[model samples]
Every structure is written in structure tokens, then in C-alpha cells.
Target chain A: MFPLSPILSPKGQGGGLRILTHVLALSPLAVLAWDFARGDLGANPIREVQFRTGKYTLVLLVLTLSCTPLSMLPGLKWVARFRRSLGLYAFAYAGLHFLNFIGLDYGFNLRLLREDIFEKRYAFVGLAAFLSLLPLAVTSGSGWARRLGKKREQLHRLIYLAAILTIVHFAWQDKAKTVEPLVYGGVVAGLLLVRVVGWVRRAARGTGSQTSSKEP
Target chain B: MDKIRSSEITPEHIYLGRRQFLVGAGALTASLVFLGGCRRLSELAPTPEADFCGSATAGATSDELGDPLSACDAATHYNNFYEFSLEKDDVAELARGFKTSPWTVQVGGLVNKPKTFDVDDLRRNFPPEERVYRMRCVEAWSVVVPWLGFPLAKLLKEVEPTSKAKYVRFESLHDPKQMPGQKDRSFQWPYIEGLRLDEAMHDLTLLATGMYGKPMPPQNGAPIRLVVPWKYGFKNIKSIVKIDLVEEMPTSLWTAFAPQEYGFYANVNPDVSHPRWSQSSERRLGERARRETIPFNGYAEKVARLYEGMDLRTSY
Candidate 1:
């Protein structure tokens, strides 16, 4: 008889692995917090901290979304378990990035802040990206998931739109089309294409199932 | 699962993790130490006094006066864009090799006396005076600079401009071997600048030989440069070699490159906007926020009289 065991059973083999994964995922956040506390954020610390946090947030968000495709592989069941924590970390960084911009860049000047958001195209894109991420971040925890019910999946799908806006925010700010933004855009385009293919297959299956049931 | 547990608990794994942590912490510590050192280094570079180079005597005051803080700050910070090793700070280093004593100013065109005046002779002929004025750049930045030199009008008096001389064209030193910018054909060099007869004679306009109570740093247009307040920074040409009284307007470096962007007059005006950015606001050196730029950079009281009954919009 084969050993009758769940691959990721919480009580057995996966418990230590789960703790290690959490530590690895949370380390960046801890380092960033330490950096802020020490005031070792580099010259022009406000800009430096905001840029780094925003960049890392986007990377983590992309990585969280990538878990779904990775988990589809036979040997990669553990990848799905890390997605929730990765997403929470992304939200944490994004919030910090937004707060830094408001406090440092605007100095809480409401009138100037409003003007910047409305008058400047780059600011508008950034604001849009922030707004898109807000709902997703709010709905990330299990409590919110339970309350959202059917709407939970819809809210999470907004991450795709947020990711696109993030890319635009970066690209538009760059006067020259340098390699950094281009690489981000390429990765995002590839990820979006994977979703598109999945959606098409699902739609095709639905149509085929309907025809077979009618014939039977 | 058993194999994975052994791998996780291995001595190599623990050692590697500890080593990585130490390295990361060490790198962070080193950077912090370096930054602290930099702050100390910056402090060591002597701070300028509030009234640096200002007149010490209460009674003796020059007509050309400016805010002293702005003047000293500008004298140090803002500089001519000499892209070569003779950059603003390093000019003293590179300039020691060059011979500035044998320099000559070629006076030709509509001047009655079309002759080469040795720099020493010119210096002796016109006694140098000190003038402090606000210098504003087209890039929407400004500084108050105290210039030590004589008026161009005084120099013009000696040359004796002919009746045909309507415009005064000034050219900068042109040696590709010396000035690397001269090698580029994109800009016509020796950099030429022109001023109308009345404008050149204006009391505010000075041919500066030195700044900050010392001989002009080689980077700050050593020997001589034109200082025209109420005009954009570029109008103040550097390291002049020739002064020609001409009939037509001489081609200016900035204006020639982009006529729409830079006009012949190049007078500082808040109304005239640069294509890329607004000219209405300017970042005064050491100021927190940008301030509204004034017409003729606040020299309208003196310079506006010269442009009486003339359209500034056309000239600008």
C-alpha cells in the first residue's frame, strides 16, 4: 500500500517549510523598516525610499500572480501556499510607498496635491494605480474574503489593471525609454497573455460542454 | 521529506545563512560610515559669511549693489558650462598650464581704432570697478553675483566706434586644443554675442575681470567676460578675445541654435516662456521654493528706460 498522505499536510512534512517560507517572505519588509528607522535611506531619502518600496511592491504583486501558473506544474504544489503571504507583503510596501509620497513630496499640501493629481498626467496615472490596488489590498485577508463572497474574485482581478497602471506610471515618468521600464512592461505583457489564453480555453470548454449536453 | 529536513539542518546551511546576514549587515554599516564621512567633508569646505565681499565702510557704497548672500552663494555654486576638465571647480587645476598674460583683444569692424590691445594695456587704460547684480539663467535658476570690472562703455570710449557701428559683437577665446567645446561644429565658436549701442553703453553693463575679491577664476571666465544684468545668463559671454562694432546683429550661440527658444535680446522676462518649462517662476539659489520671476529680472527700473517706446516682446 502507498503512504496515504496529503502533499502539504499542515501537521506533517510542510510545517517547517511553511515557517521558512514566511521568514523569507517577511525579511524584505523587516529590512525596509530597519532602514527607515536608522535613516540610512540614502541621499534624498524621501525619493529613494518611495522609489524602492514602490518597485519592490510591484515585483511582489507580479510574483504573487505568477504562483497560479507555477502551481499548475505537478511538482510545485507548495508554490500556491506562498501566494497569500507574498500578496500581503506587496500591499504593505504599496501602502508605505503611497504614504511617503503624500508626507514627503506633497508635505500634506491638499491644494497642491489635488492640482498635481489632476494637472499632471504622470501623477494621474500613479493615483489611478494606487486606487486600483486599494480595493485588492483591502480584500486580501481571509475575513474580507469571507465577507466579499462571490465579489472576492472580481476584486482580486483588479490587480491585473493595477499592474498595467504601475507599468505606465514608471514608463511615463522616464523621459528616455530606458531598459528598466521596458523590462517591467515585457514581463507584465507576458503574464497578461497567459491569462488571456486561459480565459479563451475556458470559454471554448463552456461552448463544447453546452453542445455535447444538447446532443446527448 | 526526511532528506529535506537533513538539508535544512545541515551545518553548511546554518553557516551560509549566518555569513550572508553578516555580509549584508557589514555592507549597510560601511555605507552609513561612508555617508557620515561625506557629511563631515562637506562641513570642512569653509562656509561663506552673510556679507561676504560687501563694502566694509558704511559711507562708501557702489551704485551696483546686490544681496550679499545670493552674491557669495552664486559666486561659488553656479558656473560656466565648460564640459572639459576645465569645469567650474577644476579650471584652476587645468588653467595653470595655459598662458593668460600674453592675451590680446582684437578690436575691428566699424571701430575707428581697429587694433590689438594687449590685455595688460587694456587693464591699465580702464580702471576696474566692482559691480554686484542678479544673474538669471534661462534654465529657471538665478544667483546674485558681484563682478569686479570696468564698464564696457568705458572700454568702448577708448576704441572710438565709427558712425556705421550699430552693434557691438563680442567673441570668446577660440582654441580647439584648449576649449574642447570649440571642436564641436554644432556651435560656432569663438562664441559671439552682440549688444545694441545703447545697451552696451548702459551703466549696469560691465566687462568683468575678477570676482569675489580675487582675480577671476579661470573657470569663471578668467581674464575677462561680459556681465549684463537684466538679460539671461548666456548673454554674459566668457573669456572674450574680440570686440567688433558691426552694422548687423552678430549671431549668438544660443539664439543661432534655436531662434524661437532664445531671442537676440535675451532679456529676463517672466512673460516670455521657454518651450519646455515656464519662465514665470525661478529657483533662487538656496531658496526652498521657486519665486515669481520679475520683468527684466527686477532691473526694469534702470533697463526699462532704454527700451522706451520700443516693443520688448519683439526684441525678446
Candidate 2:
């Protein structure tokens, strides 16, 4: 049998890191729950919650993308371990964001939801990002990883597309080119550039090794 | 199915029954608390005065105008898009720090009398009278606020503008240390707004310093703000610093940023829609209630004459 324990096994000694990640992930939800209980949702609670969750989702998604680049730094080797959890947290927030939009904003009216997805450019981008993540989330389990074999990594590449769509959704929704969206766009670009450069270097190394072995 | 059958009742049903009981108890407790809170608040709140400004002469009545509750509700919620804070609620909170005392307004540009008048001096000279009017915001929300202020025409008359002056431009306060939004370059600081000479001189147009009962809340533009009933809320610039009687059409913040989205006139016409969103309907403050927007925010009879022979669609 192929050795799968390294990827599947939970970190035995570094359990504190896992706990910290869980705490950070739950902090937003806890605040939301408290706000709801206190009835401090403000004038437009639906819009407020939707905007907050969406912004955090984008922030966490950017953080997830930054993990590899961050891990490259000598002091930040542990950052790579949190990448999967961060991505999952981002997906969870994105799910809540979509649910809030549908439940509170649209009241689960399928027709209005369909119309928004089709007619509104920002809605279309948001819907695309949500849909792109669905497959990645479903295939996240190790069972599915084993079933998909080599294709698991290829399917996960859709995250880059989802991030781009999310940033576009934010940009289009903003009436003015404000600082928030511009900063998000810049960070996302930097993260994607790092990924692209890393991929190219890996491909070049593989090609060089194959040619050298073939010549011998 | 037969194998699963048992003589004892399932624990799931018992758990569900307990859950239902707890939910019922919780709801009852909530209502009791809510009622008690409401009673406490009502006790604390000052009784609604018959006349907010005591300036209402004989024959001036609340019913003669309309419902006061509706007017008060409209005044508070629908506001200009002054994103001074990350959260919308922050506007009211942050504005409390603003110092409105010893405020002065500068009047210049093509006007014969170019001078700065203290806010108290302006108030003492002008002497505000209450005017009940509808306020419509570009965001498709509106309210009928009872504004207490002097007429804009009265102020304009004091500062005699030359015949060449066809437009009047208003600038808002621009100190970034105070107005945090000014620190960012998203919009030009000292937010500029303007009106045509005729519109500025209309008797209905007001330079408001107070609303509801007391002096204007800082967030609602304490000291002074314009109230052009016919136009959208943004046209009514707040915390005004300078008033320039100009000859040319001044570049408004909203118009300069997105001309297609916000027009120069920005009249509150239900027929003329914003480029991004529909303006046909408006949500009145409180729970899920909405009303159709009216032409000139239902003041068409009084103000529509000004826009006669002009296309509202194009102007909007």
C-alpha cells in the first residue's frame, strides 16, 4: 500500500498550532452570533453581515494563497501547515456569505437568485466563485484524494480562478475605485505571481532532470 | 422495521419535546424583557412637544402638514453617502466629536458682499422657521424631515450676487484630522455641490441648522446644511465651509466621479432611474414596508414648475 499517513495523520506534537487556527476561524462566527443574540444588527443587518462575511472571506482566501510564499521565509516554515485549514475557513465564510445573500437579501426566491446571477455582473462573479469552490470543497477529503489519484492537484488548481473571480466581484460591486478593493487586488496579484514563478521553476527542473537521464 | 421496533419510547421524541418547551419559555422571556425595555425607554424619552421650534404661529398645526412620526422616521435613516467610517453606524458615533461652536461660513465668488458670518450670527440674523418637506436619497430610500432653518433665498438676498453669477456652489468641511474620510483621495476633499441660480433662490430651499426638535445632530450636519426638497439628499451638502456664487457649472463630487451614475440636477423623479439601480420604490424606516417614490418626492406641485419644458430624464 502507498504511504498515506504523512498527509492524513494529524500533527501529534504541534497540536497547539491546530488549536490556534481553530480559534481564529471561530472568532468571526462567535462575534456574529453575539451580535445576533444582542439584536445589534444595525439598520440594515442583512447587508452589514453580508458585506462583513464577504470581506473576511476574501481576506482569508488571500491569506491562504500567501502560505507558500510565506513558508519560503526561514522563520515562517510553520505557515505551510495552516494553508489547508485557512483555505477551508475561507470556503466556510464564503458559504455563509452566499447563504446570507440568498436567505436574508433574496429570501430564498430562486427566480430572483437566478436573475441576479444572470443579470448582475457582480452577482455573476460571486456565484462563479462560490460554484468553483464547491468541487474543491467536496474533494477535500483524503478518501476523495485517493479516488482522484493524480487529478486531485489538478482539480485544486481551480482555487486560483476562484480568487480572481472573487476579486472581480469586489471590484465591480464598488461604485468607486476605493482603497479597499485596490489593496485586495494588489495582494492577490502578488500571491498569484509567486505561485506562477514557483510552478515555472518546478517545471524547468523536471524538464532538466528528464533530459539529463535520457542523454545518459 | 420489525427489528427496530421496541416497547420503550425513543429518546429522540423526548428530546424534541424538551426542545420545544425550552423554545416556548425562551420566547416568553424575550417578550417580557422587550416590553420592560420599551417601557423604560418610553419613561426616559421626553414627551413629543406639539411644536418643535415654538415658532409655529396660530393656524400652523401638525395634522395640517402630516404625521410627525413619519416625518421624524424619514429624517433619521435616509442620509447622504458620507462614508466617514467603515461601518454605517459609525457616522452618528464619530460625528459627536465634531466641534460646531464658533463655526463660520464664507460667502464669496461673484457676490458683491464677500464676507464670513459666524453660525450664531447667521442664526440670529436669519431666524429659522419650521418647514415640513420630503427628503429623497439617491440610494432609493427617503424620509419626510421637519427642517427648522431660514430660507436659502433670504441668505442669498443678503449677499447680493452679480447678474453674471448663474450658479451657486457649496463646499463641505475638509479637515482630514476631523473628517477622517477626507484623508483618503477616493473623493476630492471639501466635497463640492452646486445649484442653478433659480433653484438656489427658491423660497422652499433652506439652510437648515436644526431638525426634529433640538439643534441639528452632528451627523445630520450640525451648525448648517442645505435642504433642497426637490433634489436628492446628496445635493444638500452638510457641514458647509464656503458658498461661491459662480458663473459656470461647478464640478460636483458625485458627478465628477461618475457622471453616468449621478447627474448634475439629481432631481427626485421616480421615472428617471439611476444607472446601476432602480429608483421606482423606496423603503420607509422600520420593518419591511416600502412605498413608491413620487415625482419631486411628492412636492411636484410646488417645485415642478422650476423644471418646466426641461426633460427630467436627461436632467436626472
Candidate 3:
């Protein structure tokens, strides 16, 4: 609020915002790598890596969802430009989370992996979330968005479904303390609620105008 | 005895920093309680200068399977004591102010001679011995620890169990003021666990007082805790205040909470998987790769006979 030029950059076409988003997104990975290199990953390093990556993915996904709501505000229109980058970063972390699970934890054993997908509920939900995010990530390029047109929006609505699945995956994975995942679920619910209320209002306004025009 | 490498140990500065923080926090809590004109729920006892096992002359061995002992920091800091906290890393800090000194454990209910034994007396009566054990958690993690304590059978023998005693029930302290987790209704307070009389009297069942040549940290269940190597980690109750020899099979907290997931006889059988995940292999702390989990956590040869006729799959 104090100064917009530093963050938004008047003539830079959201260049400052883009730089800020990249810095925010990549810093978690950099810190993780630094911790790994310094042997500070703690007792269960594999578990630690998996936990941090999964948590980062959730955080980025939540932020990506927030941009649309924030863009509706008068001065926050530039936030919409950061959504695609944030989603892609979330996907990257999810990919790393899956890799750590299958490779580091399970040693890339196909039989074990297959069994895990079929038998483990948490694993199944995690896999579903990753698969849903895959298409959105692949189609994030402007060329693909233009080629698909209206269908792209339809396909990208899968983010909502993916976020729910991700939350379920996290809640199911926890052993006893469920407060953390429940808090994430609460935030996602609030964001979805905002979208739902807005849609309802728009629908009601459209119906009123249609009736008024027909009477005239 | 094999010494843990210096590099494996936690740096002295970090360890001392944690100690200083604990002391500072304890002083702050005391001052706040004093100023508020309320009786403190439980005051932190000054740290015991020496370990109860410090006077032990008996020598100890390394891990029975020749595996390296887990670092002292990992064994002490990382815990699953739900009484203090649900988070593994938070337990150490949260349990810092727990009172362990001036404790007593009541042994009664179907015993020929019921007696309330002071913790210090128990330490003196039963000389401490070190036993290196491989502990397997239901969450598919394992650690090898050098625990200092005497066999549970020694204590069980002191107060002879009547013929009616079929199972031994252990109850942890239930002061909600001291244990924050107990305040939550998710789990019934005063965590309870039980073992079959034979299992309780088994040669391998230990009443651990310390680990890593130091007094048991509060997070690891100071004063005393059970160490049943042949079972899942949950079966080893912590900070026990009461022991009762009962006529009927007693229900453990996990068993009561989720009967299907946690059974009364939670013997570690890799072939029998947990409902949520496979227990076929476990990630050993400080190790790069997962290793195949062993039945009875590698103590099968010594304890398998106990479950010779019973179907482990059904029991599990």
C-alpha cells in the first residue's frame, strides 16, 4: 500500500511481480537443497524431504487459489498473473513429493508401488491429486490455452477437485494429530465458499434482467 | 561397549542451547504462576545431577544384531509419547518441565504383597543393566537403542502375582496440567496398556530407567517405562504410575481406540500388514535406505515361542 512502483513496476508489464513470485516459489527448494547438502535434514531425512515437499505443494496450491479472489479487489488485479506460475510450482513440488515416495521410500519397486496404489487409501488419493494436476501443468503454456479456448477453462476447473483430493490425502496420512490438515481444509473451504457465493449472485442478477426485459 | 562416533552426536552448542531454553522456560512458567496467585499445576524439579544407572558396575553390549546404536539425540528428541505431544519432535521440548523425581509406582491388584515402591527405592533395589534392543514402530520406522534397566520379571517377582493374575495392566500419569495432550478428548486420559502375564514376566521385557548412558529424558518417559522389544512401540507404555495384575485381559489404549488396527498382542509380524500401510519394510533413522522389517523386530528367535500355537495373523 505504501508504494506500488517497487512491487508492480509501472512500465514492466508485471515484471516485478513475476520476479517476486519466482523468488517466493524457488526459495523453499533452495533451502531444502541447502539443508540436504549440509546434512541437517534430521533423523528421518527421507520422511523430512517428503513432508516438506508435500507441505510446500499445499501452500502454493492455496496461494494459487487465492489469486482469483484477490484479483476481484480494486488494487489487486495484478495477482491473477501470478496464478499460473504458482500452480506450476505446486505441481513441481508434488512431482518431487511423489518421486521421494516411490524412489527414496519404496526403492522404485514396481510390485510394491502397484500394491501401494491399490491398497493404501492415502497413496491412492495422492496419486489422483497428482494426475489431476498433470493436465493443468502441461496446458499452462499460453499457446495451449489459446488452442483449447473455452475447453481450457473447463479442464482447469479440475484444480478445485485436485485441491480437495490433496487435503484428503494429507488428512488420511496423519496418524493422530489432525489439526494441521483440518486447518488447510478450512482455508480451502472458505476460498471455495467465496467463489460459490459470487456465482449465486451473478446468476440471480442475470435472471432479474431477463425477466425485466421480457415484461417490457 | 561400542561408543557412538563423535560426528554422529548432536553438536554440544545446540544441545546446551536446548537445555538453556528449557531452564528459561521453566523459570518463566514459575514466575507467571507465582504472580497469578495460583498453585502451579506441577513445578519442574531441578535436574538430577547423575543418572540412576550411573552406579551400575555391570557391563553392556552393543546392539544384539550388531547394528549401530541410533544417535543419542535422535533417541531422546524424537518420540511418540502422545501424553506429552502428538508431534514427534515437539515431545522433547513439551515434556521438559515434567516431574520425574519424587515419584512412586503402586503395585497391587492380585499381588500377594501389594506395595507402593518409591522410584528411587526401585532403582536401588533392582540394579540397572544395559540392553541394546531394536525398537520397531507401527509407522514403519525403526531404531536401535541401548537402554539401561532391569528385566520387568525382576520387579514382578518381588511382588508375587497371585494365580488369578492373568494380565499386567500399566497406567500412565493423568495430570492434565502437566500433560497437555491429556486435555484433549480425542483419547481417553491416563493412557493404559497391558501385557499377558507371561509376556510381562519374559526375560527380555525391561523396565527402562535410562538410555545412552544418561537418565531417561522426559520425552522418552522418565522415572520408568516399559520396553517390550518383541512388540510394536505403542505396546511399550511410558511414565507408568500404576501396575495392576488383573484376572482378565486388559485393553491397551490403541487396542481400545482402533481394535482392528491395533490388537491386544501387537507382536511385530511383517507378513501381517497394518490396515493403512505395509509393515514389510521400515525406514531406519539415520540410514539412507529402508530395510526389510523382521518378525518380532529381530527378536523372534528369543521370543517367538511365546506365540507358537496362536495364529499371528488373527491375533494381529
TM-score of each model, paired residue for residue = 0.57, 0.74, 0.83
For model 3, the stretches where C-alpha displacement exceeds 4 angstroms are A1-11, A197-216, B1-61
iRMSD computed for candidate 2: 12.7
- Each candidate's iRMS in angstroms? 8.9, 12.7, 13.3
In model 3 chain A, the worst 10-residue window by lDDT is A207-216
Best by lDDT: 3
Docking class of 2: incorrect
lDDT of every predicted structure (CA atoms): 0.68, 0.72, 0.80
lDDT, residue B270, model 1: 74
Residue pairs clashing, model 3? none
- Give the per-residue lDDT of model 3 (tens digit) for A1-216: 114535555564445445656766777787678667766665677887888889888888887887787777765565576789889999999999999999998899887778768778888999999999999999999999889986887688799889999999998888774697999899999998887776677667777575322100
Best by TM-score: 3
Per-residue lDDT of model 1, residues B3-28, tens digit only: 57765665965654554454345334
Please provide, for model 3 over B59-148, each residue's C-alpha lDDT reduced to its tens digit, 9 standing for 90 to 100. Answer: 344576778877666676569999888867667768987999889999999999999999889889998888888999999888888888
Off by over 4 Å in 2: A1-16, A68-81, A108-120, A208-216, B1-87, B108-117, B132-134, B140-144, B158-163, B269-285, B288-295
> Which runs in model 1 stand beyond 4 Å of their true positions?
A1-216, B1-66, B71-74, B83-99, B180-190, B275-278, B309-314
TM-score of chain A of 2: 0.87
